[model samples]
Target: MKIAVVGPSRLPIAPPFGGGLEVFVHRLVSALRLRGVEVDLFAARGSIGHIQSLEFPGIDWTGFEASARDDAYPPGAMESEAAAYRRVRKLLERSDYDLVHNNSVHPAMLVMDPGKAPPMITTLHVPPQPELQQIVDTLGPSNGRFTAVSRFTADQWRIPTPVDVIHNSVDTDQWRPGPGGQGVVWFGRITREKAPHIAIDVSRRLGLPLTLIGRCVEPPYFRKEIAPRLGPDIRWLGSLPPEEIARTVGHADVALVTPEWDEPFGLVIIEALACGTPVAAFARGGVTEVLKDSPAHLAVPGDVDDLVRAARAALQQPREHARRTAVRRFDIHTMLERYLTLFEGVLTR
Candidate 1:
């Protein structure tokens, strides 16, 4: 089947350039192709080179965050987004693909009509965004099926139709066990919602050095909230490539996840577990779903003391057990199989 995988148009599909959603798209496209499925990736410029691509314009959220004064959307940003959607709609209208998999939460949801387009599946990677929610409502039940990355997200978002939980995945072979050293590790977008500062506090409270990795989206947040906290004990190494991240994080004794928002899926947690690293995270959104088997490690959301205590307990958990859990639950092969099933179902229905 010829599949058109519509990737997030906000950033490039390459690593260290985009966040969770981009990584998911890049991996999915590559895996689908490897399985002998004819796939075409529709992503922003500068995406993976090996695959067939249809490049589209994308608005850089990092650039918007840097220039905007208030929490409001930057000028001309929405206009450009609309234009991109029009472009995608025109392409879909003209193309002949068996299935179109949308991995974006933008105007494409508003512009593309399932009745007029090929068999399509839109994956909701994050919790309810107002515009995307409006589009889902407008599209209604019979339009298309929506998939959520986690059950918590599916339940919380409350889309008109039942949303399937197809949890995000990681490559276990790429992120395997190692002789973990002392100190805690934290990684993800360095925005306030991710709360890298909380990880710094936890590291300081425990007297263990902290390693921070990820791209800083909000410059002011980084300069004011995160930059001031950096020192010999607290280090922010910025973003690293996937292989480098696995290698660097594999040596860490524990992975500290401090998300201040309702994260749809804690990809970092699974990645850490894949590296035989245990996670002590704030019990927020889908975090518990990922670490349900290791419940002692989850603390009350935003509670620093509780998180610190949980981290202490998490350090004692068996690394081999953590790695095994990751292999059983979040492996890429399982994710790919589930995705293929979804695509075939969509086409047949």
Candidate 2:
């Protein structure tokens, strides 16, 4: 089958990825191709070399935050992104592709009629936003097929139709185990909502040096909140490539995830577990759901003291158990299978 896959316009679906959204798109596209499905990936400027791509006009999207917020977009940022999505949506309506797999959150794509488009499945990777919700409300309950990264997000949207939960997955082989070292690790976007600042505070209480990885897109938040806290004990490593990220996670004694907002799914949690690094995360949104059967520790949401205790407890959890949980729950092949089934079922219907 020929498919058109759409991801966020901010970054290419290539490494070093900006965040989990890019990583998920990259993996899904590659996996689909491997299964003999022809995929035309619609992404930003630079993307994976082998796949057929229809690029979006490049725009700096680092400034945009959640679309629900008033200040989510800088001047023309939203306009540029919406224009790009609408352009693709037009093509998708006329294309002969068997189906459309949309991973982007921009509401412009939803402006089209459901009857005119091919079978489209929108995977909800972001939290609820007013723009998308407004379109969804107008479209009514049965507009299109939907899936979410976690159950919490599905409930958050409160879509009247059935929304499947396809929790994100990782390749355990790529993120292999290592003899863990002394320091603590925190990775992902260093934006305000991600709250790397809290991780720095938690690291200090533990008395173990902390290494912060991933891109810093929010300058004001990084400057006002993160910069002042940096020291020899607490340092930011910026972003690393996929392999290097996995290696770094493997070497850390414990991984810390501090999400100040309702994260749809904590991809960092699974990545850490894949490396056999125990995670101590704020139990908000879909975090506990991901760690439910694992040896990772969970603290009450927004409670620093509780997070510290969870980290302390996590350090003692068996590394083998962590690895076991990742293999059992998040193997990439299982995710691929489910996606394939969903696609075939959609086409059959």
Candidate 3:
């Protein structure tokens, strides 16, 4: 089947990326091509090779950093996004693809004239934004099929359009078992919402070394809340690529995934599971969904004491069990199959 995959224009789909959406898109494209599906990726310039990519010009995520800090959009952000929409619309008007799979966070839906285009499906990778929600509401059911990364994220949408839940996937083969060491690991964007501080607290309570990874999205939060706590026991390893993360974090005794906000999905936790490493994560949003049937390792969100206790219990949980269960539920193959089914169903209707 031929498909037009609309990737996020804010960032190129490359390694050491700022967000998970870009990585997910790259993987989806690779998986689709391996299955002999003709896929066209609409993404930012300078994206990595190996796929049929249609580059689009737009402001990167760095342009919106200030607005992100203030919980608003940058002044020219919308204008840049509009230009991207126009480019995509023109391409769709000319192309004869079977379907368009939009991964863009931008409101491309506004430019997607359903009258002239093939069936489209948009995946909501994040919680609903006000402006995007307004556009979805305005379009109603005419905007085509919608899917969310998780049920927790789907529930956050106030729009009347039905959203299917499709959990994110990880390549289990690349994240094989490692020789586990003495400490626990924590990784994510070093923003306040991820609550890296809580992970440190859990480590300290149990007297285990906590290796912290990831880039600092909010400098002030790291300076004010996280830096002071850094010491011999709490090591800041900084951000590493996915291959390195699998090798490094896999060796840890356990992983601490503490999210202060309602995380749409915890990719870190699933990656840890794929590495045969037990995870002690807060019971919030998609954390519970990802850790289904592994309730013994979950603690209340932001509760350090409970997290410590859970981590201790999780240490005794078999490493092989975690790897086996993760492969069965979250393997990339399973995710691809489900997506293929969804795409075909949408076309058939």
lDDT of 3 by residue, 85-116 (tens): 68777778677999999888777654577888
The models' CA-based lDDT, in order, is: 0.83, 0.84, 0.83
Give candidate 1 regions above 4 Å deviation. Answer: 50-54, 60-65, 68-74
What pairs collide in candidate 3? Answer: none
The global Cα lDDT (0 to 1) of model 2 is 0.84
TM-score of each: 0.94, 0.93, 0.92
* lDDT agreement of model 3 with the native: 0.83
Q: Write the per-residue lDDT of candidate 1 for residues 37-121, one digit (tens) a residue.
A: 9988877777775233346555655556666322345667667766766777777866799988888777564456656778678
Alpha-carbon deviation at 295 in model 1, angstroms: 0.6
The digit string of per-residue lDDT tens for model 2 on 1-349 reads 9888888877777888888999999888888888898988898888774334457655554435433222355667667777777788888888788988889878877665677788788899888889898888878654578999999999989576899999999988898987788589999987888888899899999999999998877777888999998998988889899999999889999999999888899999988998989999998889989988743488888899999999999999888989988888997888899999999999999
Identify the runs in model 3 with alpha carbons over 4 angstroms from their true place: 50-78, 159-161
At residue 342, candidate 1 shows an lDDT of 86
